[model samples]
Target: MNAVNDDPNGDGPHHDGPHHDDLRYVYAVCRPLAAPLAADLTGVGGVPPRQLTHAGLVALVGPVPERDFAEEPLRAHLEDLDWLSETARAHQRVIDALTSVTCPLPLRLATVFRDDSGVRAMLEDGAERFHRVLERIDGRVEWGVKVHMESEESAAPRAPADAPRPSGPGSGRDYLRRRRSQRTAQEESWQRAEAFARELHETLSQRADDSRLHAPQNTELSRAPGRNVLNAAYLVTRADSEEFVELVDRTKDEDQGTSRLRVELTGPWAAYSFTGDEKDRAE
Candidate 1:
């Protein structure tokens, strides 16, 4: 794969001035220039944000002291969970700002180009691919739906005392048996929840231009505060987004599950989750 180079001196224009160390590149794909860049957006190491455009797409960039994102420091930083989280959040802030006014293809974390020429080269060489992606997402936006099973204690049916108990050697064995039972019950609950999620997705997909299944995140993601079960995104036509929401609302009412399973729908966001460099991925 042709990855963006983060090395400041690699192949981009040389900057020997004081601000030379303050520049870094940020990524976005096939977005209209009119889209708003985040007011507070800064580059990799707090460099002031700037824009780089080629063809019909635009990217937000900034200058960073080369030492701040030096290869060695970057490698170590990438491994730090806190660093990763903060970077991801900043990237999202930029994406969110652009998404408000234009359909943008969001790049994953750490996509950096050396300079304007590099960005232009990528866009020029990948023009056809970019064009295709823009065509597919021209009038569309992405919406997310998640399904989750509430705590087992909240959803599981209480077993009667008469229910057969595992004849165990000690309380430990009984405890183990109960844990196993809970695990099985939780799995069953998730299965049912997933089924309803799929049905709802199918129904909405009919009205969407495209749909995709996103990889599941760990329970830690729940700390972000939302009932995201099936982490699915849809590429909906701009005109139909409101209708889609109404349809989802209706589905939620019709498929109400045991207190355990819950559904949520979010976004009319720029097709960030959907649009991307066609040469990189068809979607």
Candidate 2:
């Protein structure tokens, strides 16, 4: 991603040196805010984010050193786990703060430009798409819901203490029977999980403006207690958030002790999943 600048002070963000120029990083875009943001909010590179308005839209940006953000250097930085994590966290901090005040169209991390002109050009190029997105997602947020089912081993029943420890031949037969029973139970659990996920998504969709189904999460990466059966996002209005939350709560209660299934709800995030593909954002 390229980066931007429009420094008021001669010594601040954008550098107009003969050999080097600092870059501007865009965080998100939205309408002119009704009120100014909190004074202390900061973003990537530890710089405070400022609004740059063009064509009646606001692009939230901040400056970063060209030495670190310019093309070659940024590619190297992206490979550094610690650097990427820290930068991503700072980027998210600004977006989170914005979500509290407005429905912002968040750009991907590392959306940069060479100068304020470049940033404005991008806004000009993407205005129509941006406007459509803004109209679709205005006054709304994204909610994530994931359903996980406990492993069969965890849900399997234990043998009764009073049951006999059978002779060798009988013990082997009993073991085989148990294995077959476990397999049957596992199959049943998977089917039940699928059914529950579909039902839940359908119910939630009626209350949401839009819905997206994501691939189930990897158990190894998520480190959750069980396998994910449903991974979905819902675009819901702020006014209906409470009722949506209550609906989830009711489902949670209904799910209690049923195959040890669990429903996890996340966010009131900026309509990240609902935004259509935005071109010219990071190019």
Candidate 3:
């Protein structure tokens, strides 16, 4: 939707010129390369992403209407959940495209500048910091690991001998006792799951150059069979990825018979978790 120009005059903050004196939506910054991105890769507003280089750093940017991308208008648009989600997806698409061929320093979603000169200025000012980060993650990729507690129903059915005796009619005391036992079992199960998650994270962290633990997602978001207990990211060199995967598989297999915790590994993504922490971002 057009973010401005609700009036009839039609002189909105939106720029309507070939020069595109509008705001620039920045997707990422990376080491200088000879060629541009693929023809299919596009940025915000469905515009072809362009490259701006300064001090050996290359920024991927695209023109966006100032009416929709300026500080105030952008903040308002972000409050619209649908708009925000779609925009975030679009932002990630650009990052993904760059990630496929280069180690891009992904900007946060909706990062914008007044023009290409502003982007160039940022690159000039932060050139050393950018290069340091780029070097650190040059040959590495990120992986995500999560552990969840398996649902009780999905576990192997209890054998007849292990099943609890049902409280007969008029057996109040027995019913109360059974309820207490069930609650205790559930509490113990959750504790065990947490312990397993910590153990798994520790094991995997040893195999990675850097590691970070993110808050576990809720059931609705995770959509997994069990309660999510651990959510983490690992930075591993491309050469060591296979060994890392193998270690995860072996760890999960060993825990299968002893615990109802399941482990999941996903990645080779841009090093989002290991980009030198939140403090390193350009303001």
- Alpha-carbon RMSD to native, per candidate: 7.1, 5.0, 8.1
| TM accuracy, model 2 | 0.86
lDDT of 2 by residue, 189-261 (tens): 7888899999999999999999989999999988988999999999999999999999998998884455678
In candidate 1, what are the lDDT values of residues 65-160, reduced to their tens digit?
A: 555466777788899999988877777766666666667676667766555566678778877776788788887889888776677664558889
- Give candidate 3 regions above 4 Å deviation: 1-19, 34-36, 151-170, 221-225, 252-259, 277-283
Flag regions of model 2 displaced more than 4 Å: 1-20, 156-167, 256-258, 277-283
Model 3 compared with the native: what TM-score? Answer: 0.80
Better of 1 and 3 by TM-score: 3
Give the C-alpha lDDT of model 2.
Answer: 0.83
Task: List where candidate 1 sits over 4 angstroms from the true fold.
Answer: 1-18, 35-48, 154-188, 220-229, 254-259, 276-283
Q: By TM-score, is 2 or 3 better?
A: 2
lDDT of each: 0.66, 0.83, 0.77
**Candidate closer to the true structure by lDDT (higher is better), 2 or 3:** 2
**Largest lDDT belongs to which candidate?**
2
Question: Evaluated with TM-score, which candidate comes out highest?
Answer: 2
